[model samples]
Target: MSWTGRFLSFARDERVILVSIGLATFGLVSTMITALTMIRDDNEIPPAEPKTQYITQDTEDSLQLDTLEKLLDHPNFSIKEIAVKILCDRAANDPEVITYIWFGITRPDYEERMDSLRTLAVLTSQTGNEGLARLHDEKAYSALVRCMELCMQSTELPVVTDIHWDEYYLRDMGERFCLMFLTELINKYGATMLVKAKFVEKWLAKQAWGNTPEERRRNFKDYMDYRNNRITDIVNRIKHSRRGLRALEKAGLIDKESSRRRIRELPDLLMEVEEEIAAGEQSGEQQSRRTREHSAEEQRLRRQHREAMVLNDGTRPLGREDIIERDASPA
Candidate 1:
């Protein structure tokens, strides 16, 4: 009676265990199958439609200049960029295109303004079509000045926490593009265009360095270096131009008196720029030395405070006054 009862009880327990294992296995397989099905469905789903329809080069080329100009004001950034590219190509031949593109600087959209600045820069660049003299006309120069003024007005740097960071970033990009355009113009025509030099000097003077004193010092040094390099480039260009003027004078194509006057002016400009460069280098070195001194002082204070903390045996942190007193009283 005891053997039969034990056997039957063991058999019943084995069946319960087997059924529980089967149920658990079935639940696991069900979950795995559900997940696999979800992944397969996701893979089968189509991608989202693009914001703007893709235009082939042929299609873009077929678009009228007027149509492209109108697209400059489109809300879609890509559309504006395409318009600017087309306009840049057209502006190489058509002076009227400059008129259309220059007005883009006044556009409320930062993207449009940036694209316009870029296009204008390309048009007036040294590598650009030299035959398009209108690219450096008073109207174009005025547009550049207007763009620079806008940039200077919005020169306040944006932070990550700022809600207008995107706008600020775009504006900053536009400013850089405008500055490039102005630099190209200055290099190519500065020998004759006194206003360009004066305007650039004014713009450079108005530039904001940075938010913090340390940042200001570092950025100012970099700014001085940039200015020094720019002036050096101008001086070199003047020297090259004077050589060309001398050649022309020898060839009797240019009046000797006029060429001599021009040559004399170039040397004066070169001397002025050299003096400015010398001054900038001296100022930059002083600033850098002061910054280094400041950083060293901060490091010394930090190291002394750390030593004071260790000297306290981790029992209590020393206050600034205690650290100063400890340093002052002891060797």
Candidate 2:
């Protein structure tokens, strides 16, 4: 039989085959219609897995530890991104994760590391764990500082969500984290790191708690007054010892009547020292050239003077007694 006649004979006895084909076709058409409907629907999402945030003490502790450990293995960008998403979604407090994140900043692979740092910044601010004060690396410390500076400048009320209703809670946490970070820097590195890092002074003088210009402008006068008051408080704290003031000066983070002259101004202070060194080198070279020139001039003048003396000897007459004695003795 021909192939077509054989195929027709094969299906002619199979009513089940026709039903199955029809059903398969219907299924495909239904799937296509459903897909089109989904595409047209703006709000359709594969219903998100219900997120469970930790509220109790133990769960939070566990989550934090888990995230902290996860940080060590997350050298890959994709893994770290996934880990942060998980941590932020759960809104779990993990002190270990917080430290790990800060520690991550010191890692060489930290070019892709900002996500974890930003996550820690948000977490520490949310949980109010003062342990964030333990972070000491200058760069990590600065990133947290910058994040807090930004958070404080946000004028918008906290977003009300099914999760968080109190804006101030997060704000307070952020403020605490920032203060803790600064306080830790002051306590451990004694603010000298901040000054040497050139971050503390810049942020203190111009930027608001957040680095935004508008916020700084809005809060500048108030910050100035507050800084004055803060200085007074610092002075009182260090009232007993010259060492305290010296430490502040060394850090270059403080500016006041006593500490003002002590704290080095950023660009000018460093530049002036460099310029002085350069000038000294240049001066030394010039001095050496001048010294060689002066020596040559002195030698030339001496030669001229000696020649003049010789010429004078040749031009002038001897004493009359000497000449007479010489001529008499010779005769």
Candidate 3:
């Protein structure tokens, strides 16, 4: 008989077949019951945990963090808002990312710098002591001072004004909260909180004017002077000048070793110095002309003596003692 017919016959007519079928059914039912029991027991199987990924350069899934680092360079307003969201959500804990964000605040694009500063203030407020303590260094305060200045707070308060928070009304609470916190800090401690440490204090002194538009424009000019070989490299040549070097050393914003390395990388350090010298020369020339105008009589006598000497055919006095006396006479 075929295998199928034989199996059917065995199952239908044999006691052995019936016994085997009953056992097979029992085993299958028992296995299902065991599985259910195990599932119901909390400790029977180890629990599975949801996976979490931290922010990093390689993180492709986090669009906000990725875009925030590049927000200062982007022209789109919506993209910047999305970037702010991502930064507030994920990159707050990452120092490098935070530093990159600070760069945007320090050297921003369009309103991106302003937007980034608002986000930073919000994060600072939310993180409280934990975040503040971590950022107690000079660089953090310097950046904060600049941000506050940009917001028009003379005291460099952490609290942001309506001008900063409500201007665009991007509808993001995170941005508003940041502005509020910053404004509050400024309102509470004024600019002192911004210049807490001695190093930061020194940086504040040097960059005191840096927050102002005019001062920043001047700084840009100074930077250009340095770049065009007008003045000394403020970072390098100033190393020996008491005010310059001391300020540089006390500037916690710069990593000393790193700054030194960067200074070494640069080709010249006295571009601004040259500019200053040139400016001085021009001023000196102007002053000299003004002096000659004020002493016209004396200048005329001196000029006459010079002309007479030149016309003397390389020898002899112009008109003897009278000419000499007139030339020597004070106006």
Per-model CA lDDT versus the true structure: 0.53, 0.44, 0.45
lDDT assessment of candidate 3: 0.45
Candidate numbers sorted by lDDT from highest down: 1, 3, 2
* Model 2 whole-model lDDT (C-alpha atoms): 0.44
Q: Which of the predicted structures, 2 or 3, would earn the higher TM-score when compared with the native?
A: 2
TM-scores across all candidates?
Answer: 0.35, 0.27, 0.25
Instruction: Point out the worst 10-residue segment of candidate 1 by lDDT.
Output: 285-294
lDDT of 1 by residue, 1-331 (tens): 7999987797779777899899999999999999999999988968798796677878867998678768999999977876776666655667566677888995766678878776666655523646235655666666766776676666664332222222323446666665556556545454323243234344433445445545544554444344433433433343334444554344333357766776544322233333343345446432211112246555554344434322233332221222322263232
Instruction: Give per-residue lDDT, candidate 1, residue 99.
Output: 71
RMSD, one per candidate, in order: 20.7, 30.8, 25.7
Segments in model 1 whose C-alpha atoms lie over 4 Å from true places: 1-89, 121-127, 157-171, 191-198, 209-331
Tell me the spans in candidate 3 whose CA falls farther than 4 Å from its real position.
1-90, 108-110, 150-193, 196-331
- Tens digit per residue, CA lDDT, model 3, 23-85: 999999999999898878956667699897555655534454445588846789875654555
State candidate 3's TM-score: 0.25
Q: In candidate 2, what are the lDDT values of residues 184-251, reduced to their tens digit? A: 44533334334434333433443223345444433433333444333223233332223444544443
Relative to the true structure, candidate 2 reaches a TM of 0.27
Task: Give candidate 2 regions above 4 Å deviation.
Answer: 1-134, 156-173, 207-331
